[model samples]
Target: MSTKILICIDFSPLTPRIVKTGKELAKALNLGVHLVHAQPEKPSAPTAVVHQGADPSLGREMMKEIKELNNLKSDFEEEDIPCSYATPRGKTSDVIAAEAAKVEAPYIVLGSHGNGAMYHLVVGSVAEGVMKKLDTPVILVPAQQRLDREAGR
Candidate 1:
């Protein structure tokens, strides 16, 4: 059995709910938590026009993501839960599955945006992709439930 639960963080509105679910599961299972943020790969440019130096804006964006991840880690630490994080550049589902495998996590936690079938068919869903790739258990938090409850629907 693995000692930690790997939680996928996309910084979406559903992120907090996903984190909350991860925390609950971690506590129940007496496990640590590892958070992963899949940073999208940057587009390639032709060598002729490529700038020699790294883009300043891209650096700033990375720093911001690091700060957010650190903040989430601190939250878990404050509650006496072991916490760690990683931000890897790649396809979202691939990064998530790779991280889970790397950590040997017992469970993977993430959110479903609850998009309709048309949207999913056109753009694909990360949750679906990750499930297809990993044998590890996944706890998927449904974003639509939270929205509906908040609206008293």
Candidate 2:
């Protein structure tokens, strides 16, 4: 497999910066881009019973994510970038790391929301987990920095 830059998406508004970083890296390295969006397993109500072909809500959520990924792919294509996207179902960090390995990506670019330590402890840090779990080099762009750059500050 050829080397590519993996862009991890978490449905955040900071997505553009992550994609921008991935595109720049790909352009500089003359490599392709693979966009990976991992939706975490959602907790169901205690009364909810999950069975095969039974979750209408889950289906709708999946459809929404698929549409978003397609839109992202289109954005990259418009930039004349070689881009492929996937929205895989699993733990965010695991899915992202797996995608990086699957595509043999030498570099992974993603954004950090810069939430506080308590927030991270409660919600967990996907970027941190990805960096520790993956062997590939990862670049994490901070959301505040991206915003400042965009604002010309």
Top candidate when judged by lDDT against the true structure: 1
TM-score of each: 0.85, 0.78
Model 2 CA deviation exceeding 4 Å by range = 42-57, 121-124, 145-153
> Mind giving the per-residue lDDT tens digits that candidate 1 earns over 74-151?
999998899999988799999999999888998999998888899999989988898899888888899976679779
Report lDDT per candidate. 0.87, 0.81
Candidate 1 at residue 108, lDDT? 95
Q: Tens digit of lDDT per residue, candidate 2, span 1-153?
A: 767789988777888878888888887888889999886676432223353434567667667878988887887778777788887768888899999998899999988887778999898888788888977888988897657876999
